[model samples]
Target: MEHVTDTPTVKAPAERFTGDVFLHPIATPAEPARLAAALVRFTPGARTHWHSHALGQVLHITDGVGLVGTRDGNVVRVRAGETVKCPAGEEHWHGATDATLMAHLAMVVGDGSGDGTSWLEPVTDEQYAAALAGPGR
Candidate 1:
């Protein structure tokens, strides 16, 4: 095994995120590996846009509390040490709660594509508000 250097943190793209979000890329293996991982941090109320992975994604909460929602109006609260799995091609969004910062290790399994996520529109404020109002799982 080879040693890896510390990676830089970058601001998440505004087009794909709401509020303040940052990403510290952890792993991006060569082509045949088809995997990518990152430590994603979200400020209170920050969230990702609607997106789906070609294969699927797994998230392990690292700090604070987070919300993961789907297009079907389901929102689940995930805390530190908790893990979430999103099936292939399931449209979803996730981020910090209204008053808590959240961080998670996001591991994405791709479908041989360098970029396997199909990023969709931003989740509307109404959608987010409704999610927060609903009960968490």
Candidate 2:
């Protein structure tokens, strides 16, 4: 049994996030362990850049509401207790809504090469607005 008190909470890099975001690492096992977990919090309107995982990712919403969008313009509104699965290599972005703070547990399965996610451009405001105005749950 290992107690984790060393990994510090980090501000999500600006290059990869828009607005204010925080990441609280939960687990990152040693070699041969490919699973990693973190609690990511997004302030109102904060969001990640488009990105994809080498394997896949699972997000379990823990607080407030947010939106998850795919390249195909499918945006999903996720609330507390909801879960979202992003398949490997699927380009996507997720963030808090314009009026709400959001938090979620992000569980990622890596491809054993250490870095598992490829981050792309920040989501545009127009895109975000469309998500809010578009029809989706």
Candidate 3:
């Protein structure tokens, strides 16, 4: 087995995310491979735009607190050691809580197009506010 030594840490683009986010790719689909994985870090208030994957996605939280929400307005709080899954074509968004920095390992299956996700609009302020205001605080 070859050690992966060339993968680089990348800042999440502002066009796809809010606040500060970074990621280190752990694996990428190459030819025969069909899976991609990354370690993603998010600063407080940082989050991804609403998006969906062609073959589903999984987020395994490794640190701090985070929130994951769907188009239906259900926001779930996830903490370290927790994991969340989004079914294929299910629109969703995920990020650190407003006061917490969070990190997670993300895994996705590729659909042969070299791209697995279709990103939509940023999470509106009202949506976020409503999430934070939901029961359980």
Candidate 4:
């Protein structure tokens, strides 16, 4: 068994998110034997841009409420203690709701050949607003 050393926390990129957000990388691609995990904190209305994983991604909600949206027009409201599985290459976006702060442990599974994630463009305000408007609005 190998013990990992403590690592410093890092601020999430402003370009990748909105509002106050932070990320703590628990593992990385370099450690393929281990799953890549990130502690993600989102301020009210903060969220990630639409993206996908080459392998897939799992999210376990730690606190508050989160919203996960898909290109097929599915928006799921996930709360603390809930686990969400996003299938490989499924275009999706996730973030905190407008009224709450949210945090989740995001796990990105490594592809045997590397190239585990593929990040797309940021979610446009128009898309977000439309999502907030609810279905058939």
Candidate 5:
């Protein structure tokens, strides 16, 4: 067995997200692994843009409530202790609810080298508003 030593603890930045909203990245791709994990804290009414993974991704909710939506109009509400999986190449976006601060562990497989993830444009406000309008209205 190989003994690992001296692993340093890294802290999440105050502002590590993109776009006009606030979402912190606890960990990133530079952490020395093919698998990347991040503790994303989303502000109310904030979310990620439409994107896809080359080898799929997983989200483990840690606190509050979150919303995950697909391009096909499938919106999933994930709560603490729940997990959501996005299949490879499936376009999707995730974020906090309109009234809650959501926190989740985002696990992305496959590094930037081969068959990486593709991040598309941000989710439009119209799409978000429609999602909040609830199902089959």
Candidate 6:
């Protein structure tokens, strides 16, 4: 058994995120381990840029409300205790709602080539609004 000490939380880079976001890395890909995990926190209206993983991702909400949007213009509202699975190579973005602070644990696998994610572009304001207004929950 390994007792991991608490690590410092890092602010997400402005180039990759909008508003204020933070991350605490839990585990990272290393020799003989292809798994990566992080505890991500987003302030209201904060979010990541559009990106996709080569080996998929799993998000487990820990607090407050969050939104996940896809390139298809679909948006999903996830709350505490909800788990969301994003298929590999499907571009998506996730963030906190306008009125809520959100936190989640992100788990992902590496593709064995040290490549895990491909970042596309920042999500446009129009796209975000449209996603919020999209049909279905």
Evaluate model 1: give its TM-score: 0.95
Candidate 2 lowest-lDDT run of ten: 27-36
Screening candidate 3 with a backbone cut-off below 3 angstroms (N, C-alpha, C), the clashing residue pairs are none
**Between the candidate structures 1 and 4, which one is better when assessed by TM-score?**
1
CA shift at 48, candidate 6, in angstroms?
Answer: 0.8
Q: Candidate 1 has which clashing residue pairs, if any?
A: none
Cα lDDT of all candidates, in order?
Answer: 0.92, 0.92, 0.91, 0.83, 0.75, 0.89
The residue-by-residue lDDT of candidate 6 on 1-137, one tens digit each, is: 66889789999998889899999999888868898999999999899999999989999999998899988877899999999999999999999887889999999998887648888889888877776666643
Candidate 1 minimal-lDDT segment of 10 residues:
108-117
The TM-scores, one per candidate, come to 0.95, 0.95, 0.96, 0.87, 0.76, 0.93
lDDT of 1 at 136: 68
Better of 3 and 5 by TM-score: 3
- Local error of candidate 6 at residue 44 (angstroms): 0.5
> Candidates 3 and 5: which is better by lDDT?
3
Candidate number with the higher lDDT (5 or 6): 6
RMSD of each: 1.3, 1.3, 1.0, 2.5, 4.7, 1.5
- Residue-level lDDT for 80 in candidate 5: 95
lDDT of 2 by residue, 1-137 (tens): 77767888899999999999999999774577788899999999999999999988999999999999999999999999999999999999999999999999998987777649998999999998999887753
Q: At residue 96, what lDDT does model 6 achieve? A: 89
| Candidates 1 and 4 compared by lDDT, better number | 1
What TM-score does candidate 6 get on C-alpha atoms? Answer: 0.93
lDDT of 6: 0.89
Per-residue lDDT for 1-137 in model 1, tens only?
Answer: 86889789999999999999999998884677877999999999999999999888999999999899999888999999999999999999999999999999999976675648899999999998988888862
Cα lDDT, model 6, residue 105? 97
Per-residue error at 8 for model 5, in Å? 11
In angstroms, give how far residue 80 of model 4 lies from its true place: 0.2
Poorest 10 consecutive residues of model 5 by lDDT? 11-20
The ten-residue window of minimal lDDT in model 3 covers 128-137
